[model samples]
Target: MATIKVGVPSEGDTLDSPVADRFGRAPKFIVVEVDTDTGEIVSYQAVDNPGYTAGSGAGVKAAQKLGELGVKVYAGPTPGPNAYAALNYLGIKVVTVTGVSVREAVKAALKELGS
Candidate 1:
């Protein structure tokens, strides 16, 4: 099976970092590779959020970046309309996760993926 890559908007590089409330405006994104069979986090890395500095169409730009990163799932607060549409067009799944930390959000996403 294909590895499930989940993206969480975050303020820092580690899972212990807090989750960002706004998707496009987030400072960074933590991309985690989760094992579908065991629901274990295999790896993770932080990517700079380009949209954080964009004057407009930030959501669209961010969504395109995530698509290029091969992110199959998004775990965070609701995104803006443009971003949402971009994600849908790219066939990326969005999951709502409420948590203080990125780790919590990732856990919630893994659970939702039934992994």
Candidate 2:
């Protein structure tokens, strides 16, 4: 019954929305909870990106927020250096996704995680 939490930078609350291009500056983040036993998505929620308007250190802040939310995987475009470092330090896997919907990105990430 273990669940995996994946974070996707997106434009809306649903998986059908486009994934954002910038991780740190994305307008919102979609947190998807997946059932590891069945590889099925259980639930999802959209959270406002707190670092979207920060003048500096946005990546770091974004990483911290995701960590706080218990996000073990992040799927989106390349994150800034600071954000990448922060996510690495937190043991969160970052997956590259492009020109795809949030749902597609999450499925790819889950596949990469082998869960």
Candidate 3:
């Protein structure tokens, strides 16, 4: 079945984790695979952000990590300019979403991506 993976930068490591205030330095990324045809969540993972403690270029590192993780769309606060450029180059669609849990953010991302 067709599916889309949406990622949300989060403060914690769970579906209920709150959305992180910052994207590049978020501690974790909650990624969910949702079936495009049914909109049912197929699977999910909470990946530790490799760029969380980077001294510099954190946004670019985070973008690279997300791309490596196969995140088709991102749901969180806007990233920095460098990160934005990287994400755009990777063709990872981004949608602004905050004040919500990871699960909620995934839903929003799917909607924003029209999946």
Give me the overall lDDT of model 3: 0.90
Pairs of residues clashing in candidate 1? none
Candidate 2 lDDT, 42-108, residue by residue in tens: 9999998888988998888889989999999999999989899999999999999878999999989
Candidate 3, clashing residue pairs?
none
lDDT per model, in order? 0.89, 0.91, 0.90
- Against the hidden true structure, what lDDT does model 1 obtain? 0.89
Better of 1 and 2 by TM-score: 2
Using Cα atoms with residue i matched to residue i, what is each candidate's TM-score against the true structure? 0.94, 0.95, 0.95
lDDT of 3 by residue, 13-84 (tens): 888999999989999988889898988999999998988999999999999999999988999999999999
User: Poorest 10 consecutive residues of model 3 by lDDT?
Assistant: 106-115
True lDDT of residue 41, candidate 2: 92
Candidate 2 vs. true structure, TM-score: 0.95
lDDT digits (tens) for residues 16-108 of candidate 1: 999999989899999999887787888999999999999999998889889999999999999999899999999999998866788889788
User: Candidate 1, 60: how far from true, in Å?
Assistant: 0.8
